[model samples]
Target: MRSRRARVAVIGVVVGLVTLAGGCASTDDPKANPSPPAGGIEGTVWVANEGGHSLSVIDAASSTVVTTIEGIEGPHNVQVGPDGSRVYVVSGHASTVAALDATTYRLASAAPTGASPAHVVLTPDGQRTYVTNYDAGTVSVYRPDLTPSGTIDLGGGPHGMRPSPDGSTLVVANLKAGTVDLIDTRTDRKVAAVPVGGPAVQVAVSPDSRYAYASVSRPPSVVKIDLQTRVVAGRAEVPTAPAQVYLTPDGRSLLSADQGSKDKPGTALSVIDTATMTPAGSIATGSGPHGVVIDPTGRRAWVTNVYDSTVSVIDLPTRTTVATINMGSQPNGISYAPRPPAPAEPRMSVVLPSPPAESSHGDHGGHG
Candidate 1:
């Protein structure tokens, strides 16, 4: 097995190819592309720059970085409120979750957590937030004010988590324990635990919230769990070392960012048909594609290339990459917040001269 440093070296080589193949050609001349406006754009893509210790907010429409928020240490994951009024970030190194104002990107509040908080998800009602504590082997629950509401103990390595569509349940993937835990939101307790093959890393819930697809790293497969039955329903073979799984808005398709193996680190995203429970296709992406998110319109999907420090924008309809966005070091976690609508265009008032008032015959008589 290659050491961690050696793996990084290999990733760097792959990233070089990504830049060349994906047309991410870099230039030193800053004038080539001007900076975007300071104000955040509606439907923005927020990326956690783990190595840079910052959050990069990108304008989805323009495909440009709108702003970079600094001082966040090891921001592993991010989530935006349903109404797009608040943004939450989980800092693994800092062991805290920071809540930020959606408009100004200013720190609103922060809640302490156990060691190595890996990911966060918000309830559908936007009243509560749940965070996965990787090292602590528990899930931390928080209120909107960033106050601790409760905590649910779980198996070792509670890493990735997502709330059910209806906000009735929370699904957590335990890496070390190699199991998936389901928690009842109403009762605030673990309802079920399903043993996946091994090292379940990330999960994505279906649109109806009836099923959850989890990426298992050990055997390299996506396991589908029936939420109602709380049992393993099926599995789909993906590329080796699937790192993250995401379901499109319609929930008809599932996308997996396969991290590949020691011999072959994945440089592609696998597309699966949820109905058929089979691999439909694959879209070539940059090396180390870690985070995946779809736009509100469901027209495009943004994927973060960790090793390349870039984001690949894939046109959903075409299933082809449309653009590559350059980012800071090791861009990993990403979330999409619909840009607030632009203020209505100022109403313009125009005074037009009234039509010659019924002067047809009268004007003729005056002329005579």
Candidate 2:
């Protein structure tokens, strides 16, 4: 979920409303033979430039901007297909999900969504896509080709969410209601809403799908909820108001992007030890750290500092930020697609779809 300052500061933030830099971002380590990336980064990090109304593609190994894809209106969130052939983006201003060809950066098709759309998440199998509608209180489902499937109403501002690794359940944060709702994937039906102590912003489901870690804005904390028992198991305090929660690949630690409000911006990324359910430590980053994704190796993480308009690359093993990439304004969301580019050259492409050209690519796959 985006911060209150962003929605207020940037109209495109689809923050429909509101809307970085660093004092602490760094460079390659010099102690040992420096690796291009701290933890041998791979793939690319796609960032949703909510204010800029574009997407910035970062080359992981080199930690540089390969390109900036433009022409989508107010993209708040972006998700890549498993094969890295497609990218799904939800625009709050357009109230639609635009599926674009990843390589060509062309809008393949677009499907309308609910009011005040927030985040977008695809099923692990990539058969289904879910978009959270904040004002309408529903989640819009779509086929891989961007065709409308159905809708699930959970009420009270459904914002950030994640599907379980097992592909059986979807856990979402209801910002307006201060609760988390679970949906059964097979039936697309409401499972349960477990209330936490504060406004739930974003979520990270455990690799096993047995637990969920929700980022709570107020009180600045992370609450661990047992998915099976449907209750709060533990709560850990963070440095500031966190936006996104991500679990390391090994599931040993949960990284919380401490994105404090613009009026009171935070400068750190909070870490929670999953086993002990306590604060592991904090990593200084750019201001208003928003979306975060860890590398497959679990040794590195990339964080979007919304206020600073920069990304901090964290070396997880040292609990430190090893690099920062300057980006377009107000980078709100981040996703890692673990596939190498064909030519691996820098690209700056802009796709403006004509009325008829805005159509779907053939089906990628059926529901698994």
Candidate 3:
């Protein structure tokens, strides 16, 4: 049973939008599953403005808002495909997941999921997409074409999910269950569940895929779990309420966007060293930093501040915020896409041997 507020939120999106398609497909059908694109479009950050019901595209280099896509109902999370061809957005209020063209930012397709589809993550291979249903206690699986493929039951509030770097496993943070569900993507089934003793908000797997770090809100800590043993390896203290956690590209540092206390209003990002399992330092961000994503180069990090309706760009090496860009109302979700480097200009074959010979002879005469 959902609360009245939750019910109202779910109902709000249904009023004026077209109904999403509802159907399921077999995972083994080759025609139903297409391989992900080989490359992705780079140099843009996509953000989900939950309150504004829109998506904001920001130019990574200039830190400017390129565009704001309207008409999305409660866009709670946003993710770009590995190849950068498509963008996926989860509308919790609409109970739907919509796919948009990565370059044009137009709606490509959409499909309904369980109640309160909160977060979405695509497989590294880009063949599949997994979405966590916050209130339904389930995860919906979709093919690359945005067709619903199947569903996995977790019996808890499934909020945040991430696939391993190798695409072998999917780690889901069950917010209400206070446990982490590990799913083997090969079979698309839950293989194990580890209790973390608090409500889990987000999960980030190591680059090597050996461990997964989960942010626990109740005790204000992040728990490290050994993927092989399926047990709690260690824990590190964080801020009062950590909304999202992500690992750096090098897997050297784990960053948490701590949404500080309501009275205090948190504006800090907690940095944890993976080796020591302790807090290394904290970088100040905007008010209510809820989501974070690191650039492909690992030099800069972008964080969405919900309360302030802005995004803070952090310089990782200096551990300081370099700029803050104003976003729409309550920007909650963010993702990074690496832009392809510009092609090098063609070089002209200049004949400089005659000049060099003259310079050599003249320099010898001057020395003599």
Model 3 segments more than 4 A misplaced: 1-4, 7-42, 340-368
RMSD (Å) of each candidate, 1 decimal: 18.6, 7.1, 19.5
Which candidate order results from sorting by lDDT in descending order?
2, 3, 1
Error in Å for residue 5 of model 1: 12
TM-score computed on alpha carbons, candidate 2: 0.86
**Residue pairs in clash, model 1:** 42-339, 43-338, 43-339, 260-266
Local distance difference test, each candidate: 0.72, 0.75, 0.74
Using TM-score as the measure, the top candidate is: 2
Model 1, C-alpha of 341: deviation from truth (Å): 9.5
**How well is each residue in 1-368 modelled by candidate 2, as lDDT tens digits?**
34322333332222211242222232212121123554466787888877666787777877777667767656678888777888888776566788877777667887777766778889999999999977678999988887889999998878899999999999999877889999999999998999998778889999899999998877788999999999999999987778889998878799998887766777888889998899988888887888899877787788988776788888887877788787766777889888754342343544544322222221110000
- Report the lDDT tens digits of candidate 3 across residue range 237-308: 986668789999989899998875434457898999988899999999987778999987788888987766
Better of 1 and 2 by lDDT: 2
- Give the alpha carbon lDDT tens digit for every residue of 158-233 in model 1: 8788889999999998876888899999988998889997778889998898999998876778999998888888
Model 1, residue 155: displacement in angstroms? 2.3
**TM-scores for every candidate against the unseen true structure:** 0.82, 0.86, 0.82
**lDDT (Cα, 0-100) at 81 in candidate 2:** 74
